[model samples]
Target: MSFDLTKAETPKADDAETETAPEESAARRGGLVDFLSGPAGRNLGLVLALVLLIIVGILTGGERFASTDNALTILRLGSVIGVVSVGMTFVIAGEGIDLSVGAIVALCSVWATTIATQTMAADYHWSVMVFVALAVGAGCGLVNGVLIAYGRIAPFIATLAMLAAARGLAEIIAKRRTQIIRERGFVDFFGGSVAGVPVLVIMFAAVAAAGWVLLNRTTFGRRTLAIGGNPEAARLAGIRVQRHTMYLYILLGLACGIAAVMLMARTTTGTSTHGTLYELDAIAAVVIGGTLLSGGRATLVGTVLGVLIFTTLTNVFTLNNLDTSTQAVAKGAIIVAAVLLQQRVARTGST
Candidate 1:
């Protein structure tokens, strides 16, 4: 009887262990699910995609694609568009869009390189030209914000109008000619490198860092997310939806200004044609970076990676002698695929 009791108790202990094993497994599964649902989880896919593209480029293009010079070139080229993409991220996250960022860059660059600003640079400080570019960009963004937020106009139409207007203004200012940057210090410093890093690359890093802080660490960022997630709800929550919307546009405009400076420094010329089709590039990068197009989500790191991916792709294409038209086709396909993937993810998450 004693032996029988001990055997029965041993079976009970085994049963308890079996039950606890499932519980422990479920706990780990829950943790993994939570992680996959988080932002980092979302970005992981994009990072892997980027890594795959790099591998493909290396395999296809050989040493040229993997060279340090090409790598620097990709970064330098990507920085300008990357900055613009950062601004676009905010705009899209706030349930809004801007079709005029490229045009704004053109306008800002042209304005900064105008005779008046250049004359100021010659007489006073080269920094004055930098200020002018930022001012023009901020002003353009302010107009877009006011129209969308207060005027109750749609973002698409408002920014479309701005696209035409800003480009037109740039053309008029530059008289349909390229405005060469002749300010020696402006050319040397911005076009030069610091500790072997391109100034453009440095500027991109600074802007990305600042944007991450603004979108993650500040009240403004939270409000922006609230508004984008649900405007009516945000209004009920005591957030000034309209004003905040306007602020978002202004922030984007400021980014364009900074990008204008970078473009001017890199190319040494500002033209109405400078940022042509850049709007599409910025939008593509933002979307690919895992930022939801329906708003309420933003990822600066994702956008940076998106920029790098696009830039690297372009570099790979160029190295392989792919035509511009072919690149356009590929880019369009990517945009559609990304949108579809997002939809699928959203559906899965909802379930």
Candidate 2:
């Protein structure tokens, strides 16, 4: 009986170990899954890509590419586009596109830097120019939202029309000339910085941080994701898909306005050519940052990294004496690679 009891207890212990092993294994798997889906995991590839680019810069451009001044220059140049990219993130996340972002930037800048706006700024305050730029940006966004969300026009068609009209309007207003900003206060304030960082860079950081929070921690963001994932389903779920879509466009407009102000400060002039090809750049950055072009997923961190990558890439190319055509070719290749990688990731996730 004693020998039989010992054998029975051995079997029970073995069964217990078998049960615990699976639980432990499952716990480990769950943790891995969570980490991969989290922010750090989401951005790991971009981080590695950035690091590799930096290494290339160091190797090819040596000290010139590694200098702190050059680094700041990259950030400074990327800031305006980075801000615009933040807005583009929201729009694209909601399964909408705004091919008119560049045009809108040009229009806002021209409007804000016009002689009339300058005179008003001189009489009242520099804030006048800021307000005007914001108003114009929001207004254009409103029109786009209305056309797409309510009029039921496709995003591509609406934004394309806007791209043409806004650019034309900007050309008309500026008479195809650059409008110089005369508000010393405006320039000094926006161009100025705290603790040796450029104000433009600070603005970019602030906007990016805010965008991340808004997109991740708010009901509006949830609704945007829901709508992007499935518009009909989101509408059926009482998400007010149309209204939310309108708001997303308007949010993008506000970002364009902010970017306009930053651009004016950086260049001290507003021209119809302020954001040439910026829409393509923003779209590329957003796509490369891991946001789905088909919607339903987004990543602010990825977008920031994407912006830095392009900025750094340009800096590297410049330091190495590369030409614009070469840079364009490089960018095209990177975009293609990123899309392919994203597709593979999507397929793997689905499986």
Candidate 3:
């Protein structure tokens, strides 16, 4: 038909290339959005926050803050709390709260350090103390789980009652005195390190790694997320919401027990005062780590970063000689800001 063969020969202006340019651009934008809205994105923000804190520490604390010793101190300070935060993460992810974590830590520490427990450790092995601490922690967690899961008690009330009861019990056991750890083996085991890292820090790392795997790579984690996201939906899907929920609390209890041991090692004493206000610290760390207070989502990495950030902040404040009142005020401000930012990010992602 004497068509424009010249035009056809000219490759039709390469419309495909031009068309794909827009598509490619759109794809790039989508990739960026996904990264920012996903765990990577959340962790990126935390990393940025930590970097900012580091910068602040440097500026305020000068060489003192920049020293290796200071850095180790920060990590050491964060280690115990970080372990507890990991457990707190699981509990929150399961759509539950644990106000008794601090009390449980106190109770575990006191119980493990009791005259009888210590006597057994002195007679046999320090593992006895470790076992008792873990048992106490698990027992407390079981009680909380039973009340919340089977007894149909509210998490807040149940844990609050535990808070009072546990703390009181610890006080009664310790008789308002600090119980010094006499088992040298227990202290050395948890207090020692591998390859220059503090044992406390190492334990924290191990727990965090295990927690990450548990939450992201296992069936149990999926079930926890399902329950937290929607208990009804998860149940409809055949997930055991009640039993799983109990497991979550018990998980937290074990964490508290570990934390108790760490604290006992660090301070060489177990007192009712041990873990005072720890619930607040652990909850704050978990929340700031990008875990949804209402459940459904959690980030163990973010929680670790949150713990570090707080530890660094405290270090910075201490280095700068800031008063506790000022530090408290600053913490409150950070918490408010983090929650606000989290809400904004959530909305942006949804849209």
Question: What's the lDDT for all of these models?
Answer: 0.92, 0.93, 0.93
Q: Report the lDDT of model 1 for residue 299.
A: 89
Backbone clash tally (model 3)? 0
lDDT of 2: 0.93
TM-score of each model, paired residue for residue: 0.91, 0.91, 0.91
> Which of 1 and 2 is the better model by lDDT?
2
Residue 106 Cα positional deviation in candidate 3, in Å, after optimal superposition:
0.5
Model 2: which residue pairs collide?
none
Q: Which ten residues in a row have the lowest lDDT in candidate 1?
A: 1-10
Per-residue alpha-carbon lDDT of candidate 2 for residues 1-351, written as tens digits (9 for 90 to 100): 346776665667778899899999988876776666556776997899899999999999889888988889999999999999999999999999999999999999999998898999999999999999999999999999999999999999999999999999999999999888878999999999889899999999999999999999999889988999999999989999999999999999999999999999999999999888999889989988988888989999999999999999989999888999999999999999988877766665555
Worst 10 residues of 3 by lDDT: 7-16
Q: What is the number of backbone collisions in each predicted candidate, taken in the order shown?
A: 0, 0, 0
lDDT per residue for candidate 3 within 1-351, as digits (tens), equals: 579877776754477789789999988877887787688988988899899999989998899999998998999999999999999999999899999999999999999999999999999999999999999999999999999999999999999999999999999999999999989999999889888889999889999999999999999999998899999999999998999999999999999999999999999999999998899899999988989988999999999999998999999999998998998898889888888877877786676
Clashing residue pairs in candidate 3 are none
